[model samples]
Target: MIIMRKHHFLLSCIIAITAFTDGSQQHRNTEDVSDYFEQIRHDPSSLSAFLTAMPKGADLHHHFSGAIFGETYWNVLTESNGWMQPYTIEVDTAGALHKAPWIHFATLSRESRFDSLKQAFLRKASIKDYDPSAGPSDQHFFSTFSRFGAVARYDMKTGMQEFKQRALAENVSYIETMLGAPDTAIRLAAGPAWEKSITGASLSDSTTVFNTLDQVYAALLKAGIGNTAKKFCHHQDLLHQQAAIDDSVFMLRYQLHGNRNEQPLTVYRKLLIAFQAASMDSLIVGVNLVSPEDGVISMRDYSLHMLMFAHLHRHFPHIRYSLHAGELAAGMVRPELLRYHISQAVLIAGAQRIGHGVDIAHEAASIPLLEVMRERKVAVEINLSSNEFILHVKNDQHPILFYHSHKVPIVISTDDAGVLRTDLTEQYILLATRYPSIHYNDIKAIVRNSIVYSFLQPDLKERKLGQLDSAFIKFENQVMFH
Candidate 1:
């Protein structure tokens, strides 16, 4: 049923291998490559130095807000004319809610206030506080978004470049990062009218659901979201152009992120905007659902939200999409909630990829689901650091082995490099150090996996894959014995 194009891939490999070959050593055995990789990893600094320079294909699960460093967030926050003072919520003896706001900078402006609360909030906004002996709860992990939302809200262009620079520093060739609108004021302003106009009952029928989504898309265009989307899309182009000046080798694409915890109508509106944005922009290739997967509102509306995406996909079939499914652990939620998420994401929501996917082992009949994923070629975006920091799953307990064992595709990513205080290279280093079964070949396989499973179109994907293959050949030669 299938024909193997041996020549096509082999031709590229020969071209790559030939560039490094000296007539001899063309068929250097696997042990030579393995030994070279081990020698590189044996160095204490290789994780940051050598691994950083290795050809990383892409980071598919990165979040725009979480990819910026604390210092950058602080700078962006201070760039504002006003100060965003940090606050803590407290309860009194009578159970009355109290807002305790601190200002320790002594009448100092926002920029100077960093000496006081900024560092604390930075720790609060990231895994800086993650301590295995203490705790790394999901609440603490997801709260980082809201903690730094004020800064990331307006820092897209600068943060985009910063992420590109950071990826380049790690030798990553491409990124599929989740980026939100710089300001939601316009989208929100246009929201109420759509909210009042559309009803869930009106979308009960599949045809009606699709037609309603189109109306929402058209209405958003009329309200000028089309212009804003275009502007963001163009800004993405400019960011790419700017980054390419430093290294034309690096590429980035934006995933329109929709908050999943909102009301069905609100979530639908956001999805409509995201789908429309992706449709109108070449730079934005896909849409994704973001928010705490275990949140009450998110749990309540999970199926409804999937239906929304299903309907929207019918109307905007060109846009690629994925879901943040099974980002939970054993005790994080009711057992009933764990069983259906990844299943529904693949079978119902039409997700081409699934992010985190930590609860795979906990799902009912998970083996069958894994088969579905393997058959469908649905890849899991695994973020080891984020998983250990957020879900406390690692080592033997992780389902990575299960996925790998079953031939399920896995692509390692930096879920939130800045927030997690790590990068893609560091994630690869963890894989090498922690998983004994994962050899250098497996590492290269994962790098290739990023491009293979990416939502990027065929032409663009091929371009990046060729770049990756060439880089790999050069990297291999440098690491191997001459």
Candidate 2:
């Protein structure tokens, strides 16, 4: 026994020494890279090149539909015989439209005379050449989804391939993208169950609320919601198999998200489905609440949605979810509405991570919330371009620095890379350029947070983190030698 103990201690000491040496070398290489960054900090071209080549660990807040470029959507439209209304740029894939103004993309592309028209359609499909005078930036940004939604429906594998290629090019190894949610049928089926159990119940009564949820949950299960979730998982597996997106260098996971703008019952149903799907599929890592936070239904039922999530958490305690809280700006919603979103998302909904969180400064008990986030290790996803474009909150007004100062974890991400016409590298560039206070090591830690805060399973997360470490070592060495 003594010999075995001595042998174990010796092995532990050797491992510890090796780890210390590697960590010390890593620290030196990071400092060297930081020095290089400082030299080219003010040089846009050099900084862009440096950040582009740097290894970004993961994009934890990506939306797959919004990640495909407008050009790619255009190609899908042309190939699928999709029709586009020239003025509105709205596409129809089902050939259901018989209107005079609806034109086929194939016809439009074939004719030289329609060149300017094609350019206009492309611009309308994305934020390219967006004119603020025409409307609010948020409206213009959100409207692009409908215009290209038809094209997005035709090709899932191709869109995923585009995401993989772009991510690998930028040195991003993992993506936990918001792919989709349960079908309309399953979500609508929840309406009857809600009506039966929760319609007139008092929400203030915790017992009643939980009991109502239990009843609703039982009813949904009787309605074959479990089977529905199984089918969703099976379909996901087929799509993943056909796409073959995962490999040694790149990995893709999904978050089945519920739209916050939907009705309370519908949103709850989606959450149930999302949780169920996540439990069954390893690739489906988590659930999220999406859509514009300031929308009428979203704002009205924001607390209710959080409550539903709290309820679902009880049933599926092991499932993880992130909420899109405080995606709103001051003028976008009423002042009172801004105060408790981040707080509620954290304290009430028990979100593992908070998406956007741009309104942290306005959150009631902001200091406490910040401290709790730091203590609980709840990371905030910083979407610089999206926040700037949608909320007009940028630079000094942005709360990224504030979150950092309070010791709250922050992970930089592209909310909608294709829609914003930006990527993870550009987000880092913006972070480094706009906030010089965030040093190279700080930015590196933020990159690490992307993976660390991700909803990936422990074993898979460890593998990805290992991959990220090697990537950083290689990246820093190149920067130092160069």
- Per-model CA lDDT versus the true structure: 0.75, 0.85
Candidate 1, overall lDDT? 0.75
| Ten residues in sequence with the least summed lDDT for candidate 1 | 89-98
lDDT of 1 by residue, 228-276 (tens): 6667667767766665533568777879887877765667766777887
Where is model 2 more than 4 Å wrong at Cα?
1-25, 94-99, 184-207
- True lDDT of residue 320, candidate 1: 90
Per-prediction TM-score to the true structure, in the order listed: 0.81, 0.92
Task: Write candidate 2's Cα lDDT for 408-480 as tens digits.
Answer: 9999999999899999999999999999999988988999999899998899889989988888899998887
Candidate 2: residue 451 Cα off by (Å): 0.9
- Model 1 deviation from the true structure expressed as Cα RMSD, one decimal place: 7.5
- What does candidate 2 score on TM? 0.92
